[model samples]
Target: MDQDQQWLINCLNASLDPNHQVRNFAETSLQQASLQQGYGLALARVAANRELPFGIRQLAAVLLKQYIRKHWNEDEEGFEHPIVPSNEKVSIKGILLASLDDPYKKICTAISVAVSTIAHYDWPDDWPELVPFLLSLINDQAKLNAVHGALRCLALLSSDMDDMMVPKIVPALFPCLYTIVSSPQIYDKSLRCKSLSIVYNCSSMLGVMSGVYKTETTALLLPLLQPWMEQFSSILK
Candidate 1:
């Protein structure tokens, strides 16, 4: 653990140097630390320091978030590895919720990653509380990149979810797709189309409630897909 801490400190410092290569090396180092135990939570504790470069700290925060969310609350029977607490009293979930306000995209990504992981679980009682957090990320302006990442995560996470959760999430999710599809403001056409495709796929997977979403989802998605598909078909010919 001491070696890992030293390695993290070295990486965090390297991330701040004027040299681009050093910064890149730091980024790589941090990414490696992300795979190690306790490193992510440790980085989270230090990421908000004013002395650290904003970019480096943001990357650390994001990595920390990914580690916590991906690993949290696994059932003992389902585990491939033993679950150990980073800190016995501090909730990883609480730390992630606080990260929603982080002033960096990397931190935002961490929060998004965490939310996506929670969305994959069967915590029906917890869903009402958790849904709002996930929905809030979907609308955050400063965290648009993270929002996109979270939405993709949510789209997949919600795929096999029950109807009660699905209905509530889809209404909010559909409009996001509509905005991405209908707006000319989005510059990358291919990416816009891809985002729409994910919404469509998730919409289809709603199974029984697919009918409930038909009017709104179809109204928003079908027009955009038809022309794009036709254009592709013509090109193939």
Candidate 2:
């Protein structure tokens, strides 16, 4: 309702317009270096507003990601250190997660990128619960986007965390991956691919595959992977 928010929403909305010139103008305006902080907050508001057009909200999410990568923690250590304070950070996170479930799926990519960006700075410590929250989404029986978004985010974080964290994290992750990759009832090829990608990334970490080689983990893994062994064996030739 306020004039400032309305302007931000309008700019984001304009970015979604089909006309080339209008879209270009709105895109340029939102990226102005001098006004990034205000613009970023405004866009975060629009991104979180479920009532808005999904395209506009997607635009907001993308723009907010840019702000988060560049400006989120670019300040001194203290209560007001980060350019975006703790309270606002929490609010932005809530919005991004909600958008992950956006029925349209239009905003999934932006939200996933934003989450990965956050995970880079705050994981295993600052955000100990982050992995669990994303895991719940992957395990949820409903909503395809939740699984898709969660898988995308986990893979991104997997790249940053090597074996020290992987051993601890992989146990929780593989069970959900088992459900998706092995069970056809809820199976999705794209989800399966992302799940395997997570496995592959974990294996890349120094000691991660050694942990996976254990008897208990091997038992859980074989059933899910064995059914595909014939196909894999043929491919190996």
Query: How high is each candidate's TM-score?
Result: 0.51, 0.77
Candidate 2 segments exceeding 4 Å error: 15-29, 32-41, 75-82, 206-237
Candidate 2: residue 126 Cα off by (Å): 1.2
lDDT of 2 by residue, 1-237 (tens): 699788877877787789999999987877673143455556766876778887778777877776777766664232122377677777777767766765555577677888888877777777787888888888787778788888888888888886568767866786677677665558577788888788778757734455656765555455545544654464357
Best by lDDT: 2
Of candidate 2, the 10-residue stretch with the lowest lDDT total is 73-82
* Per-model lDDT: 0.57, 0.72
Candidate 2's C-alpha lDDT? 0.72
Q: When superposed on Cα atoms, how far off is each prediction in RMSD?
A: 8.0, 4.9
lDDT of 1 by residue, 128-193 (tens): 566566567656655655455555455556555665655556656666655555554542464366
